[model samples]
Target: GIQVEQSPPDLILQEGANSTLRCNFSDSVNNLQWFHQNPWGQLINLFYIPSGTKQNGRLSATTVATERYSLLYISSSQTTDSGVYFCAVTPMDSNYQLIWGAGTKLIIKP
Candidate 1:
């Protein structure tokens, strides 16, 4: 089992700006996912990338299994994007439990 950690603890950006959030795991992960928790506490899955890169609209993510880390990129940030970004993962074998990070709080100013 491994622990997850998200960097920049907090972030503030203007509308239309771009930013990158990072997540570091203590060990190798077999399963990894990224989520965006909106202001109302709604969880929106952005990616299920275990060891590759994928883009969706204004968001994209990359996971490096060997380096045991992941990065989430947000392009053209918006006011509605203000919320917490989280990274969840399950280590190899053992129980199918997911370990979540504290999350990176993002605030998009108008």
Candidate 2:
């Protein structure tokens, strides 16, 4: 079995601030992803990094598989960024099953 943990279970920031979210896992993973649950409850895929780093606009993510952890970075935060950010992974021992983190709740002030 594998376990996923997200740090800073809750976060509050001004609209233009920058923040970093962290995800740690207990075992090796075959697939790792980041998602943002919008206010409307729609899940938006942010990254799918089993290893290495990736960036998209004001967002970036890095997964160090060897160390069993991942990081998500957000720059110049916006009100639209408010929601729940989740980290999900499929362990090396499982197929078609994703273990989800409790999620980090983010609030961006206007």
Candidate 3:
């Protein structure tokens, strides 16, 4: 079983600021996804990168399986970005079970 951990358990930022969130795993992973839980509790998939870097608009993510860690970056943050960011991973030995981190709570102020 793999253990997932997200850093900076909580974060607060003003609009237009940039922030970085991190996730660390205790073992190798074959599938990794980043998700956002909005204020209404709807979960949105942000990234599905198991390795390497990928970007979408003002958001980007990088995962290094060898190092057992991943990072999510948010640039020019907005109030809409206020939510809980989660890191979910499927270990190399597992097929469908996803281990999820406690999540990083982000609050963006106007």
In lDDT terms, which candidate is top? 2
Per-residue alpha-carbon lDDT of candidate 1 for residues 70-101, written as tens digits (9 for 90 to 100): 99999999999999999999888746788999
lDDT to native, each model: 0.93, 0.97, 0.97
After TM-score superposition, what is the CA distance of residue 69 in candidate 3 from its true location, in Å? 0.4
lDDT of 2 by residue, 1-110 (tens): 79899999999999999999999999999999999999899999999999999999999999999999999999999999999999999989787999999999999999
Model 3 residue runs over 4 Å out of place are none
Clashing pairs in 1: none
The model with the greater lDDT, 1 or 3, is 3
Question: Lowest summed-lDDT stretch of 10 residues in model 3?
Answer: 89-98
Lowest lDDT 10-residue stretch of candidate 2 = 90-99
